[model samples]
Target: MTTPARQPAEQQPAGPPRPAGRLVLAGAPLGRATDASTGLAQALATAPVIAAEDTRRLHRLAADLGVDVPGRVLSFFEGNEQARVPQLISALQDGQDVLVVTDAGMPSVSDPGYRLVAAAIEAGLVVTALPGPSAVTTAIAVSGLPVDRFCFEGFLPRKPGSRRRLLAELAGERRTMVFFESPHRIAESLADLAQALGPDRPAALCRELTKTYEQVVRGSLAELRDWAAGEVRGEITLVVAGQPAGSAQVEAAELAELVSVREQAGQGRKEAIAEVAATAGVAKRLVFDAVVAAKRGG
Candidate 1:
């Protein structure tokens, strides 16, 4: 025999096996289709199981993006999200990647998919996200208010009384507040906000963001309320300025006088006290004590 056969070419070792499955929460565009991310396109094209808030909307989005969704599509909306969680989790356990998307914006911010994400995490499944557009952040970014700190207050209660109570509770919140409202209730909600947070509170009304009729109106709550009273349309997001800094340090005498003035202006004792405390950014109890002490001295 001539020479030994040349040694076979060395081969690289295989990498570690990936987990069986993963849950990916992809954010859709708030309004415009072009805002969708490339990761969304890739996930739409490759994910084995796609759970969408609306399968029809998902298909429409895919068409707009010129991407073909070759995977199985399933409905994952509020109406059926609870029931579909188990099935989606099972797919993840089988090592299949599942993509969760909503009709607009992120899947869990004022949308469905939170339950599925929690369940997936509980089941030891890998959960990730593809960042894209979000109505909350978009509204806040364009609000022209202090964005250093903010809070998202999804949608207010549908019932007026419940909504008013909730607003009253948050009247003293020191962080910029963002709220989502329906076209029909935007006016009423703004009016309630004006009453709860005071008419002079600065706010912005962002409507139909990233869409054809996009508009952002910056003004006091009273001004926004008046504007909302007219023929307002499209998805609405309200951004409210937080209480002024140092307001919580008002002197006890001044706080008492403010409470007295509110009482004289027709507010009930408790209501006046609460309103004063909120406006002053002080504890309600402090206001209450000041009011009590003032009454005793009188």
Candidate 2:
């Protein structure tokens, strides 16, 4: 981005020096430029410093809004956020309001801005935000799932083993889950989600949210996996149904079968029952009773 020369103090009319300026974490438009909040234009015209993830996009947004950014623009992406927070905090300490904006959505969300926000807070500086379009809430609103209670899991790990492990950890989570995925890995992620959560678990795959070519695919995880087999593109957001209440437990007979396999693998009967209880989400006493009944040929 083109950096403008700093305005000299004497260039402006004399006025009382301002107090410590606030750190504003503003949400940039996710897609259409018009989606920017009303305060955005005012902030652009007045903020003394603007830290943008992509200065080009920031400039484009300013042009679309028909406003001038009288602030000093700095590249504040993930690559340089750590190195740039000190500069931003220094500006805040000098009574210059610093505005933070990402390429899209809110800053500090799966994007850069957390480090700076944290630094500002630790330094006892005022920090605020401008609420606007967010892909996370946007996806949930259209997910067709219970939105009253939900959790955002951010982006799943790239490694297959790590991804599966994370999914397994969430298998019994009762609240709806939201995730962001890359187009290239959506297919594999959906497939893994189906296996770890359940093929019949309801889910929605939201793509290019709030943009032209926006599409939402809602179905069971298994169905989504099949659909993702074809060429898919654009940014992706996934919302998955939570496990049903008391639905994770297995039947005593199935629990007995699992315990039997564990015993055959050289585990003691008591230890096998305990292991099955934890793994199958069943009570240990239930497996013990099933095993005893099987021994009596009942």
> Native-vs-model 2 lDDT?
0.88
lDDT of 1 by residue, 167-204 (tens): 86676688999999998999899888888777999999
Alpha-carbon TM-score of each model against the true structure: 0.81, 0.82
Summarize candidate 2's per-residue lDDT along 87-171 as a digit string, tens digits: 8999999999999989889999999989998999999999999988899999999999999999999999999978986886677
Location of the lowest summed lDDT over 10 successive residues in candidate 2 = 277-286
Instruction: List candidate 2 segments past 4 Å from native.
Output: 1-18, 251-298
> How well does candidate 2 score on lDDT at residue 186?
96
Candidates' C-alpha lDDT: 0.88, 0.88
